[model samples]
Target: MARFLPAIGLWGGLALVLVAVNLLIVEKQRVLDDGRTVLLALRPVDPRSLIQGDYMELRYHEALVPADAAADTASPETDGRVVVALDADGVATFRRFDDGGPLAADEQRLRYKRRAPSGLQPDPENSELFIGAESFLFQEGHAEAYEEARYGILKVAPDGSSVLAGLADSGRRPIRP
Candidate 1:
């Protein structure tokens, strides 16, 4: 009977891992299907890597939260949410840091992570603020189609979790590549 213990343990651990992975996949799919669409103005930098193909580094215009609003000075690795007010056109602009209060009808929350600046950035003080993804990968020959992308489309859940849906043009139309 002791000989079977190792096999049982291995199979049990593998089953648990698979279940956990599937649950995560289901949660992300739910967010993508049911989350609110928010457009963030983008400042893109195109860079190519021989191994990773083509991609654009995305920087959101509204990514920086006023230093005063980020009152926690103890940790540089804090993660929090920022409230943004959506305009009629569905574009989001920074309003304030999420204070666990109710959001206004036109406002939505976005998750952000704060990290120490790498010193290579132009403005190190504000560079710590990272909102959503930093890059978007595209097929090798399709970089030109995304050159006109002016916004990074995000599907944000009610709890401030977000997924990068895609890119959009100035007119808010999704750019297909």
Candidate 2:
């Protein structure tokens, strides 16, 4: 029975790890599938954490949420929503206002609340759009090959929710984040 119990525990742990991996893969795919393209102007975050290595902080030009929209939908504390639109140059543009109307039928919304409570305080300095994706801050310098080749793609839904989607491949063509 003791031997059997160890084997069972090992199998259970293995199964849990597999499940976690699968979930991450699913999420990556889902973000890629649902995300749209928006040009996030690089603010270039300074390199900090001597132990962590070098990386840049990113600040987007198009970060904001209109007061009207903020009132209607629950805002995430870590991040805020911006209306993503296509610019004349065929690149994406974002506005804090909901001028784009609604997120497409197929589009999905991602909120940025690490814990419960749902609402986040909007940073007046950065405007209404707070940090929607905490993943970005951590992602700096972790993978230069991945970062250099990849571009920032944002996936947004009808209610003004959003997620940061990384470019799938080098072409910088939008695939998923």
Candidate 3:
């Protein structure tokens, strides 16, 4: 009986792990396939050597929260969510830091994890917010092509959980391998 118990534990553990991994993969695919698409500008990146072999590292402009009206009064909590509203051009802009408040019809809530506080309080020139999917490593050796990318294509879920799917050029076309 004891010998049987050990085998059962081992198999059970492996089964649980596999189930968790499968669920995560399924959720990610769902986001990529059905989530809302938003285009975010890329903060200027040095193109000199952005490409390494095949994949390129990506950074997005939307990841930084601008010190707009709502940002100024919000508390500096790294583990909270933020509501964003799209500008006329479909660019996501910070509407307010999450405060458990009501949102405007156009606003979408995005979960945020603040990096070390910038110390620079919310102001016109220099505040930033750290949203997830800040960096992406794509296939390598395509540096020159991706260097011209100015936007990051993000698939944002209804709850504001977002992922950087790929990079895009000024024309908003996906920069594929």
Candidate 4:
């Protein structure tokens, strides 16, 4: 019975881990399927990686943290939600930091992280604020397909959690490999 107890513990722990992982996958899948689509204008960066295939560093044109806001010493590092107003085309433009109030009809919330520059950014001297992912990876030969990418399509949940669905061109067409 003592030997069986160890085996039982190991199997029980693995089961718990699997369940937790599966739950996360299920939640993200739900977000991708049912969340509102919001397009964030992209600021182009490098798009080639010889060792790891093609990728694009993503910077949101509409989501830049104001210099003053990033410089605020009161809260040097923070994670919170920011409100954006969606246009007719579903493109989102930053409105303000979320204050836990009701959002306007055209507005949606997006999660963000503000911190010291990681030095990997184009403007490393400035503080950094980012939403979703910092880069998008694609197949090695598909660099050209994403070169004209003008917007990052995000599927955003009601609670401000988001998933980077894909990249879109100027006409808002997905850039498929």
Candidate 5:
């Protein structure tokens, strides 16, 4: 009975892992298809791993909700929802439609679901940005992932909407797009 119990536990754990991995793969593809393409300046981090697999860490130049803007109610509750509007200069600016701030100069937009606990204030010296999503915060090696991410404006949607979809490079289109 004891030996059987151990085997059952192992198999159960393995099954659970497989299911979780499959879900991640599906979501990855989904984000690729529908998620916004954020072009960020990538800062690579040391790579390491355990049960799942090894992955590169990344940080972004365009990750934060501009510290100056954070004070404004336009900043959604952590991980709430933000529409990233691009200016003619191609800079990506964020605002919550609910908050009703005027859109930036450009009509291009991207959507990012708010992440809680907030992220770091924008520091010019460091081009790194934070992901406020709970999943990003607690994943096993996510710290490294965020540390190495390349930051850039993913893409611009019409009518003040953003893609807020995934973590990867976007097709380049200057800053405003």
Candidate 6:
């Protein structure tokens, strides 16, 4: 019985790890199967981290919700959801910081996790809204291929959650495998 205790604990831990990995796989499959495809315009940003490898730091045009435009009813530092409009080309434009509610046909509600005050301050560049999927990591030697990217192909779920599916060129063709 004493020797079995360690075996039981090891199996329990292994089961937990398996469960976690399964959840991750299910979530990714959900995004790929059920998420709505939306394109977000990118303004050139290139980053290379020695430890993390080559990746592109995504800077979306809609990431900046103008200071005067974003309603400040909540505390200066808050996290919630936002509704953004999608143009004909599927590029997202900031609509409003809003309560979690239904949106119009052209709009999508996304989970807004952090409100960086310094970035949200009124400035020439305007207030920036940090949504998830800000950084996209790629293979070490694939940096050159993504340098000319102009849009982020996002698979936004119904709950306003999203995953960066891939990068797209100016012509809207996916530039990755």
Task: Judging by TM-score against the true structure, name the best candidate.
Answer: 4
Model 4: lDDT to the true structure: 0.83
TM value for model 3: 0.77
Candidate 1 vs candidate 6, lDDT winner: 1
Q: Give lDDT tens digits, candidate 1, residues 16-131.
A: 99999999999989999999999998866778877888988988874445555444453344577888999997899878778889999999999987665655532334546778
Q: Where does model 5 exceed 4 Å of error?
A: 38-64, 73-76, 86-91, 97-177
lDDT of 5 at 53: 55
Per-residue CA lDDT of model 3 for 16-126, tens digit only, reads 999999999999889899987777777866533433434444555644466463245445564668777876655676667767777776777777654444564444234
The regions of model 2 sitting more than 4 angstroms off are 62-82, 89-110, 113-129, 132-177
Better of 3 and 4 by TM-score: 4
lDDT of 2 at 29: 66
lDDT of 2 by residue, 76-167 (tens): 33443344445542244443433335664333333432232334444332324443553354444455444553345566544545567553
Q: Tens digits of per-residue lDDT for model 6 on 13-40? A: 9999999999998997898788988888
lDDT of 3: 0.69
Q: Which ten residues in a row have the lowest lDDT in candidate 4?
A: 117-126
Candidate 6 lowest-lDDT run of ten: 119-128
Query: RMSD per prediction, one decimal?
Result: 3.4, 7.2, 4.4, 3.2, 9.7, 3.9
- What is candidate 6's local distance difference test score? 0.76
| TM-score of every model versus the real structure | 0.87, 0.49, 0.77, 0.88, 0.43, 0.82
Give the Cα lDDT of each candidate: 0.82, 0.47, 0.69, 0.83, 0.44, 0.76
| Global local distance difference test of model 2 | 0.47
- Show where candidate 4 strays beyond 4 Å: 62-64, 72-77, 119-126
List the candidate 6 regions with Cα displacement exceeding 4 Å.
62-64, 67-77, 115-128
Candidate 3 worst ten-residue window by lDDT: 47-56
